[model samples]
Each structure stands twice: as C-alpha cells, then as structure tokens.
Target: MLLQSPTQTVMSLEAPNPLSLHIIHLLMLIKPATSGGRFRVLRTAVSFFYMDPTLMSLRSLQLPSVNTGFGGSADTRTKDLPALQSALLQLTQAGILTDEDSNGNGLNIMPVTCVRAAMLIRCNTLLRGHSGVCLELVQALLLLLRKGMTPIVPLRGSISASGDLIPLSYLAGMLEGNPDIRVRTSTSFVLSADKALELAGSEPITLGPKEDLGLVNGTAPSATLGCLAVHEANKILLLAQGLVAMSCEALLGKAENYHPFISSVCPRPGQVECSATILHFLEGSSLVQSLKEEDKFKPVELNSASDNPIIDIKSGEVYSGANFISSSVANGMEKSRLALQMVGKLLFSLSSELINPTLNRGLPPNVVADDPSLSFTTKLIDISMAAYLSELGYLANPVTPHVQSAEMHNQSINSLALISGRYTLQAADVVAQMCVAHLFAVCQALDLRVIHMTYLKALRTKLVSKVLPFLNGFDDQVAEGIYERLHETIVKSWNASACFDLQERCKIPSKETIPVLRDHLEEHEMHFVSTRPLQRDLENLAYPTFTQTRSEFFVKPPTKQFLGRASLGLYCFVREELGVHFHQGLVEHPGRKTSGKVNGRKKRTIGSWVSIIFTALTNDQVWGHLVEALGSRTCQVRLV
Candidate 1:
C-alpha cells in the first residue's frame, strides 16, 4: 500500500496562469516523445526548465484527437473514457498519488525526487528540431549569447531552408528559461512570447509554409551589417565635409565650384546638392574674406551617385537590380581627398610663411619655436607629415570595378552592391583619420597661448601631452619620427574604437571654437544646360571663374526598356568601359560610307555600323580586347 505523508497530505493544483503552466508541461511532454531523438529530448527539457516560463507557456498546445478503442467503434472515438482512466491509473501506479486517500483527497504518496531529469527530457526534444546534435546546438547557443549585443546570429550563416533553425533553436532555448544559458541582465524587462500572449490575450506566432519562407529567407544580417557600416561612414563623411570646409575657410579656399551653376553644369544631383550644402556651411567667415587678394583657394566640387538594391514589397518580388552604385561616392570621396590635399599643401605654405622672418605676420617661425636653429626644421617636418597623411587619404580611393565581366560571357555581370558600400566606407574611414592627424598638427603649431581663444586647444593640449611633447625646433629626422608616432596613434585609436569616440567628443558648439574662415560662393552660383555650349558660345557664356569642362558625345540613345541580356551584356562590356575610356579621348564614330546611285542621283550609302576610333591612338590592345568581348556579334552595336 502506498503511504501518504506521515503528517499531512494536501492536493493543491491551482496556480497563476494555470493554462500557461499546463501548456508548458504539455509541450515538455510531447516535444521530446514526438521529436524522437535522445539528445534533442534532453536538451529541450534543460532549456524549458531554464528559460523564462512566461515566454514559453503562454501559447496553447493543440494535440491531435484520435480513437484508442482497438476497433472502428464510433462510440469509442466520441468519448474514449477508458483511455483517459487508463492513463490516470498508470500515473497512480508510478507513485504520483497517495492511494487517493481514505477521504478521497488526492495527494502524492511521496515527493518526486527526479524532477530535474523529467524536465531535461523535454528540453532535449525542442533542441533536436534545430540540428542533429543537441549538445552542440546548446553549446553554440550559449556561446552566441555570450558574444554580447546582437546575439541574434546572422541567419545567412545557416544552410537550412526548413526555417531559421539555428536562430530559432537559440530563441527557443532562451524563451524556455534554460538553466544552462544566460541572458543580458537588467533591472526591468517587458518581453516574452507565451506570457506575452496571456497578458494581451492573443495567439502565438503563427507559421505557414510561406510564412516560414518569409521568416528565414532574407539576408538581413548581412545587409544590416553592411548598412550599419554604410551608416557610420556616412556620418564620418558628414563630419569630414564640415572639417574640410573649415579647413577651406581657414586657408582662404574658394567656394564658387560648389555654387549652383558649377554643380548644375554637370547635372548630378549628389554633386550639386553636396556642393551647395558645403558652401552654405562656410558662409560668413573672416579668414576667407581676408585671403581674397592672395589666390589661396579655388572652388571645387564633385558629383556622385549611389547605387543600391531595392525590394518591391507591393509586388512581393525581389528584383535584383542596381539602384545606386557608389561609383559617385567613390568619385566624390576621391575628389574630397584631392580638395584636402590642396588644403594640406596650402597649410604648409601658410606655416612656412609664418616661420620665415621676412614673411612672418608678427608671429615667430614655426609658430611656437623661438630659436632660429630649430624653427624651420620643426615646421617643415610637421608640414610634411600632414602632406603625407593627405597623400595616404588620396591613395585610399578604392579601385574595384562596379561591374565585373563573366568568365564565360562578357554580357553577364553581377552588381557588387555590398562591396561598393564596404569600399566607400573604408575609404571614408581612412580619409577621416587623416583629417584628424592634420587637425592635430595645426592645433599644435598654434601653441599653448592660443588655447583661450580656440576650443580645440584643450584637445590639442591633451594630444600633445599624450603623443608629442613640445621642445626646441625639430630637425627632419625628429620631425618624421614625431609624425610617424602621431599616425600610429591615429591608427591605434581607430582600431581600438577610440578615434570615433574622440571625434564625437570634439564636435562641440560652434560658439566655443574660434572662427577661422568664410564662405564666399553661394549655391545659386551654378546652372545646368542639356547640351554643352557651342565652341564659340563657350567663351561668351557667363560662368564661374573656376569653370571646368566635361564633354560626352553619343551616336545613339540607349534603349530604356529592361532587356536582361542587354543589361548583362552592355553593362559588363560597354557601360564600364565607357566610364574609363570616355575621358581618355576615344571617339565613337559611325562606320564608313559607300558611293552608290539612288534613283537618278549619285548618293553615298552609310554602312549603318559603329566602331570606337581613338584619335592619335597607337594601342591595338583595346581593339583586340573589344573584339574578344563582343565575340562574333554583327548587328546593333555599342562602341566605347
């Protein structure tokens, strides 16, 4: 006879959210038995016990209804009372009851000792559905969470089309309150799946075949990482633009190239808009105004277009096409580097002028160096460092082609959208670091006495103390060594995630930083026309003093309709080739004409063909390459 608790026995089944608790137990039971894997069953059970119950138990578990009367009995299928009784009887036989007590008060005869083992069996089941090996899945899940923020594993890493099995498994283990796992600890949290349902009284996350596909098919993780990098680079670009403009102002650089007329002449949206914005930033500066007599700065701007991919949500189709390619961003980045290079060279000029006793504007040579022996050497070294950094920035321009030719056919190509963004970011990052280095040198030359007037004096003082301590004028060797050390610090800070942080700190209110420059050219100073002016009109047209020219001649307009073959072929072959060789002076000329008679009059008949004819061109390599690229095609043509 089963014995009751010697003292007292009470059966109390009521619990808060009883439905949820029941679902938890039910899931725990069926999950292991149905998944049919020893490892999976155990892992799932472990996770269930450890995971937050609220996140797990709120969803109702539905079990299929089946008849167990050992016959095709309609009545048995209707009720199946005997099956229910038999199950309860088995539970009693297993010592889950105290013989129902003398007064019919149900209670356990003895406390259960192996509860952990029972719970673990279920955790294993849920873990099994993820991958074949439950133990490894559990281990990987734990490791993933420990990796810190954004533990959501990039779903692209999984080869499973069944679902986001890897991430789903981790999420399951997390929700189930698995003891073997750890979550980010916080004082307050609102989030769970199951308990969340009961609180709002809603259904669980439903899954259908299409729904499953939607859940796991996209490469959001890869895209997110790429986009985040792009976002960050864009921010740095913004700041760099500001810094470049500031440098331009301080050095008395021209702002006319950014005017509307200059930018509109090219008709590139990014080029025009950016130039206008930058010019606006430099408005009303004293230093720029004073330098008007010296021809120190000239207006400069670049046009850029960004290409990315877009998903058509309304059509429910993924149209993989180039939206914005960063060729423009690259061009702009390169031009910005050029602009900065010019600025650095000018800074050196200004610094040298300050040091020469005859040219010094009441300031000592090398700014702070009082001794004649050290001043020039020290100043020159610092100037060279800045120039070197600027050169590095200019050289950092990514040379990757926007479209690559297919090995089998020149007509096919793939858009390196992510690659483009990545390169742009890398280039921008390097350029920004260079700017920081240049800024550091400039602040140092201004010296300690200028601190009260300049807001960056504090940063300059700290950087000097930490990296380069001032002394007597420096010779070339000492100067190069100092610059090298400074560059190293910039690199170290960047790799350590400190440079971005420090830059954020330096961007304070403008009122605190001393005004160093001005903006003379406004955006309205630019304009655009469809056709370039006639040779004679080019001289007559009123344009900015810093006007530059770009010319393009096309024999025919390209078809606007989306021809996949043409898209693949033209882009891979001509589009890219044209961008490179167009400015190199290659002329796309119509083919030769034949003398013939038409009607009663003598007429010249054109072959109606096209070919690339380079002026004064000696290279047959390009022609050979084009022939190989085009294969044996003889119909409609493109020549670059």
Candidate 2:
C-alpha cells in the first residue's frame, strides 16, 4: 500500500524487473543515517539492485559460498547468494561502483566490457612492475591497432611455440568485441564476424586454429630486429660519413681517393660502395674541394659484428643459428666512432681558430669575441660534451654473438629475440642523439662565421629552431646542460638542412646529401675498401649458429671454403699520413774526438733501415742521419 508517513516509501515501477523491486524493498527498510551520513544508505540501495539477480539465481540453485562462506578453489563450488549480496552492498556503499542497464537487468559495472578486458587493462598496468615479451606484445598490439587491423583469439600454446604469439594474442583480444581490452580502437565493438560480412556484402573469414596461429605466430623478431638494426646502422653510417667529410674539409683532403675509377679498380662491394657514398656526400662546398688527396684517415684499434637466430616451422624445430651476421654493420659502427672522435677534436680546433687573436678569422673567442668576460671556454665545453658522448657510443660497439639455447623446458625462454633487438634500438637511438649534439656545436661555430649562401643561412636557422631551440641567445647555461637529457629522449628530426645547405653551398643540384657525405669520407681516407664483391661473398658465407654452447664453436666457419672462392674478400687501404710510427731511441752528435779523430762519435740516423737476417728478418734504423735520409725520400713501401 502507498503509505503517508514521515519517511519515503519505495516500490517497483516495473513487473519484469524483480532485481529492481528487491532493491526498492531494501532502500525502504534502511533509512538514511540521521548523522548526515545519507551517502552510505544511497550507496547500499544502488549496490543491492545491481547484485540482487546474481545473488537470487545462486540462492534458487543453492551455491556453496552461502553455507561455508566465499572460500573455495575452482573445484569447491560457485559463489553463494548472501555473501555475493553482502560484498556488493559493501562495495556500492563505498562508492566504488555504478549502476548500468544491460539486457533489461540492473548490474554493478566499471568502465570495461568483460572480465578478459579488465585483465588486459590490468596486464598493461602491471607493465610498470615488469618487462620483456609481455611489453613487446603490448607494443606490437599497439602498432597493429594504429594500422586498423584486428587480431583473433590468442592461444596459450602458440606463444611458447612461436616468437610472436603473446603479442598477437594481446592485439587480437584488444581488437575484438570486448571494449575493455582497451587497445586503441577506432569504433566500439567489432560488429561480430557475421554482421561485418552482411554489412559489407562480402563473405566472412571462417578462421581455423592453424590460420589464426599463422596470423599471430611465425614473426621473425630477431630478423626484424636485425632489419631495424641495419636501418639504424645505415643512419650512423651516414653521420659517420658526414663527420669524415667535415674532417676532409678541415684537413684539406683530395677528392681522387673517392673517384669511381679508383673504386672500380677494386671489386670489393662494401669498400667501393662506401667510397662512392662518401664521395657523393661531399660533392660540393669550398671546404671539400680545397683538400688535397693524401690528408685522410688516422690509425686506431677497433672491431665489431651483429648476429641472429633461425627457426624451421615445418619440422617443429628451432635451429638457433645465424641467418645473417652484421660484421659489416659492426665494422661500420666502430669506424664511425673513431671518425667522429677525430671530428670532435677538429671541432675543438674551431674554438682555437676563433679564440687566438692573431689567427682569428675575424671572429672572437667563445665565438663571442665581442664580450670580454665570455671566453672560448664556453665553446670548448660544447666540444668536450660531444667528445664524451661519442665515446659513450663507441663503447656500445662490440662483437655480440647470438645465444639460442632454450628458455624453460617449454622452449619459451630462449626465443626471446627482443633482448638483442631492444638493445640495438637503444644503441642506435644513442648514436642519433650524439650526432645531433655534434651538429648543434657545428651550427654554433658556423653562426659566428660569415655564412656564404642563403640556403646555408636558412638551413642553419631551421636547424637552430628545432635542434637547439633552447639556445635563444648566448647567455644560457641551463639550455646547454640539458643537451644530454635531450639526446637520451631519442628525438628525431628529418629536414632539408643537410641537403639544401650542401646543394646551395656546393652549387651541385643533381647530388644528394648521403652521396656527398660518402664522397667526402673517401677524400679524407676514412672509407674502408674491400677487395672481394660484398654481396657475392655474403652469398657464399655459411650462416653461423644463432645459439652456440661454446664460444670456440665459431673458430672455423662452416662455409669458409665457399667464401674463399669469392676472391680478395676484405682488404683495407692505408694512407701514408696514417702510417705506423715508433718512438723509442737515443741520438748523439759526431763531435767526440779520440786520438785526433771523432772515435767516440754516435751518429744515429732516423730513417735508415737495418735488416736482421734471422727468424723474422725485421729492419731497424741505427743512426740519426740514415733515418733522417729515409724520412726525406718518398717510396711506396709494403710490409707483410
């Protein structure tokens, strides 16, 4: 009956909704707290309406949580009606839930669709606590979503068996009907396979287990990583080429060293190609054109390589071996490191060029010669920072062998190619950051000088605006100190600064920046020349085991005989200025006289050759005059 009392009477407005009525009955029995705690009663009323159905269904069927409480494994039994009701009431009263209508039923809800969706959300949230394959899967799913492709059901067995399983599964779930899967989706719910075909007037894909597995599994993480590594390595190679060109220009190196005629003479592909690239990179500009031939390449010690693993899907076997090893990439990385080091040193010289009052090219020290208090020290600091960062990158280059054994008995542990892939990615990022810093320093130095071309000025302005925006003026130390942090952030900027500047400065419209940089590298003798054809040799070379038990297993490559037939495989061209030097000896004049003659004379020649005809038959200079004489004469000498 409708009552007229001091309190409100709650009743069901609809007949089919028993849960709503149950909620109304509870609200009527529990009055709003008199102590201004009205929010609590309202919460209980809402909670009861949502949980009532699940509770009532269980009560009618009789669930275990009612008699023994909510304590049971998956085997014990389903939840009880009373306990479920109590938990829901407590949650609602605390304002931890909301009322949502679905299928004409009042249910307690959060922001997601189903239980799996909630778990996916939790999985991503838990990423802050852990990493590796799970994180990689999430990232891949994110990528797939960006491209508007949906993944199907994920299998537990497939991830352990294949490299891309987990990631694909995560991606598929996110793309499916469950909105809570929370992958970046363009629209809510995937219309279901049936509806999609009808709407589009096309047959629906009835995907099987094998097809689904094929879609998600079989990804070459290591290979792709290697591919990405190669891509990044290419960039570093370009930057290294640029550094070489700058050095060539600074040292006044000759262009003939990079001539196609010279590269054609030697058939080794990498050498010829590298030489060609360097030459192309430095095609124009007054600096490179002015250099003489014999002024390139400085001697140093370095070595590097990249490795990957392979799998045979048909045989259900993972033959962990190298499909491709990046010896060329590693070598390039090391060489670039050394080349950039020298470039950094040359950059330091620019500070001296501007600082010395007598040698100044009309520019002041610190490039701020107008300000007496600010000295070249500020500019020198930038150079030092570049050098330090270059060293950091140099340290990253190493001969890393691919390890493929097994991860757990399930084989899931060892297939983790993301380890190497992520590392290479990070290293490449570091290299890019270092190059940008160096570029910033160069721009600063150039800004103080007379900019010859409009393109150069324009490029310089653009580069400054994006790469070094914080350097608003000359009086900002905070901006300078943050350069390292900026580099660590892995920012990338592709502009016409390099291209336009080189073209306008060199007056060569047909040439590109990469080619010019390569040409300049050859001019400076920083380019490595090989005697054998690179691709041919690579074809004959045996793929190394991606996973080896012992390091010595690689002592003799399986395809050595096959590779040997390729002819003059890898050879280095050493320039004269970069020749080896020795610094250990004593010299005396022939002034000592004995018995009216210079009997105790010690005349040591710096350039004379003394050949010891035993064992190695090595040569040494005994006297100063002979060595000095040898130094004066120019000869093409080869030693084995």
**Candidate lDDT (C-alpha), each:** 0.29, 0.30
Cα shift from native, residue 29, model 2 (Å): 67
lDDT of 2 at 42: 13
- Which regions of candidate 1 deviate over 4 angstroms? 1-149, 152-213, 254-261, 264-267, 290-428, 442-640
**Per-residue lDDT for 1-640 in model 1, tens only?**
0111111111111234222111233222222222321221121221111111122123321111111221112133223332432332222122121223211233421101111112232222223221112233233322322222011121122221211123333233233333222222122122333443333333333221111222222222212223333333433434344444444443335666466787777976545545655555445443333223201111110010011112222232223232122233334333444444443444445445433434432223443322333233235445554555556455545444435553233113333333333344344444444433333333322221122122222333333333222312445575455544543433232223211222231222211111110010111222322222221222122111101111111222221121122122222233234321111110112222433332223332111111221210112222333223224442221000
Using all chains and alpha carbons, the TM-scores for the candidates as numbered come to 0.30, 0.34
Where in model 2 is the C-alpha error above 4 Å?
A: 1-161, 175-180, 185-207, 250-268, 289-407, 412-415, 447-640
Give lDDT tens digits, candidate 2, residues 401-483: 33343323333223334344434545555554444333333323332332222223333333233434323342456444433
lDDT of 1 at 459: 33
Q: In angstroms, how far off is 426's CA in candidate 2?
A: 1.6
